[model samples]
Target: MVDVYLFSGFLGSGKTSLLLNVISQIKESGRKPAVFMNEFGSLSIDSDAVENGVPLKEVLDGCICCTGSEQTEAQIQSLLEENKDIDVILIETTGAAHPVEALDAIYSPIFADQLNIRGIITVVDSKLWLDRSRLSPQIRALYMEQIRHAHLLLANKSDLLTESEMATVSMELANYNEAAPVVQTIGAKIAFSYIEKVLHSTKEKSDTSIISGKGLPLSSKLITFTESVSRDDFEEWVKSLPETVYRMKGYVPLEGSINPHLFQYAYGMVSWLPEYVKMTPRLVIIGEGIDSIKYE
Candidate 1:
């Protein structure tokens, strides 16, 4: 059984930056890690922050997150079969993905006993959120869905807001998801030491079982950044993102290899280690307040 963590965030939420930071921490700790990335674009991205890049040929060759659940299930199973050394499994879901569906796809019967779903981390863009209020109905619904299902809600890009504005955004998030802890971070930066440790057990506060509401998009203005990467490069890129967009994720293919790397991020905070087969490295950082775009 492997420890699995699902990293989810809307477009431009800094998921990639977070993935890189978390991966470095995992490596620094002397733990072998494999990153599973689901790039929604044709030009697969790679993470070059590390010396050893993650290969992509080994990962599912398509859109596993949005295409449906069966393939996604097969993707996880296939990875387990190909590489058994994976100590922890980190899933970098697509930006357009519904956080719940990402979890459901991996929670298949085959993986149920083998993998433990520690928690769900959702990233939200404070700037985008403010705009969500004025977006069309379909878009608003999507924003609500993301916030409602978060186990840990990252009120990212806090630097963009004033003290009073920060409180207002925090209050708004609480209204939709009072269950998760809404922490502010910069550059999606966070210490990776406790990511998996903290996620191993689900926090009672972020439970979505009590949530009621069928997700229905009210607008199409919701944004997301879709790409792939090699685990190593992904690492540096994520840390760099701590200053860029809001979120990023997907797998990174190590250079001169076929096996794909996996990772994810929210705002600027990183969570969980990427694992599959064998790999390990150590790096950790915790950003205070909202994540700055530079972290993206």
Candidate 2:
């Protein structure tokens, strides 16, 4: 039977970073890892970050807990059928997705016998969590629900917080989720061995109260650049983004660079990494009412 681990986290919480860490560790340990990634946008960006040759499947433009659930199952089924040697399947859910409903979708009887449901591993952005009150009620509730249902909680981005802030966030998360072990991490880094041990030892079942109906009023817009843009201009554009914008990521062609840079923005933080190959210059902006934001 293949072991499956679900990655649950709010938008910009570093789920993809943690997924990369786990994949590397699994590969080093001589275990084959496959990825099932869900993106809320029309284009699949993070899937590009997965190492080449690893079996990957994507559910784009929908949440796996809702509209994409059927496709998720089918993709997982296809992944398993195509890769018999895979020891583990790392499912990185859309950041906005609810863990409980996602679990409900994966616990289908169709693959029940073929897979082992390891548990939900949640990555919480410590800073945004501290500022969660600023978010809309529904988004805040969804964020909390993600943490409440985690089997293993990762307090990611702890480096950005002060000692006192980390202490407060850790305490609150502990109170919210007493069943799972909360580990503070930088860049979502954690030893895969520790993750395996904690998961194997945990016996507590997830909360069964799955939130039904439509999710938040979140949406994603795909923007493609026909030509390279100056770094200063791009940064200016990013600064102009409204507070409603939650996350933005994609490959961007920058002036003077031979290849497109991997750009990521979350909760007002921006990062740019150089890429070796030229990729389609596209960006996916995810937020509430983002369709009005135009890029000329």
Candidate 3:
């Protein structure tokens, strides 16, 4: 049976970083891995980050838990049919997705017999969580739902917070999720070996006691740039963004640069990495009440 692991977290919680690391570790251990990535936008930006040659299936324009369950099951069936030797399948849910509904989607009877659900591993941004009170009540509740159902919790971005802050975050997370173990991490980094031990040894299945009746109202907008823009101008635009903009990521064509730069923004933090090859210059902005934000 193929072991399936579900990754749950809110927007910009470093799910992609953790997925990349897990993929590398699985490869090093001589096991074949497959991926099922879901995106809230029409275009899939994070799927580009997955290493080449890994069997990948993407569910786009919707969250898998709410409106994409049938689509997800079909994709997973195709993935298994195409790759008969896959030892494990890693599913990375959209940041706004709920864990219980995602697990429900995965329990399709058609392929349920062929797979063993390892567990749901959730990544929590320690900083955003600390400031969650500023978010709308709906979003805050969704965040708690994700954490409450995890089989393992990663207190990601631990380096950004002081020792006292981390201690507080760890204590709160442990108290809220006593069923799961909380691990403080930098960039969502944790020993994959340890993850295997915790998940593989767990005999309990996913808890569906509190499933979300509906998906969150989060939305995404895809912005395409026809030409390179000045780095200073882009930075200025980012600075002018409203706090409602939760996450933004894509390849940006920068003036005077030979290749497009990979740009990421999350919770007021921005980063740019130089890319060797030119990618389509586009950005996917996810948030609430952001339809009026102009990119020009």
Query: Residue 203's C-alpha lDDT in candidate 2?
Result: 30
Instruction: Give the alpha-carbon lDDT of every model.
Output: 0.56, 0.80, 0.81
The TM-scores, one per candidate, come to 0.62, 0.69, 0.69
Per-candidate total of colliding backbone pairs = 99, 0, 0
Best first by lDDT, ranked: 3, 2, 1
Q: Which ranges of candidate 2 are over 4 A from the true structure?
A: 203-296
For model 2, state the Cα shift of residue 48 in Å.
0.2
**Over 4 Å off, model 3:** 204-296
**Which regions in candidate 1 have their CA more than 4 angstroms from the true location?**
46-65, 201-296
The ten-residue window of minimal lDDT in model 2 covers 206-215
lDDT of 1: 0.56
Over 1-296, each residue of candidate 2 has an lDDT whose tens digit, in order, gives: 68888899998999999999999999999999999999999998999999998999999999998899889889988999999999999999998898756765565444545666666789999999899999999999999989976778999999999999999999999988777789999999999999888776643222221111112233344566788999999999999989977667678889999988988776899999998977767776655445456676
Error of 3 at 103 (Å): 0.7
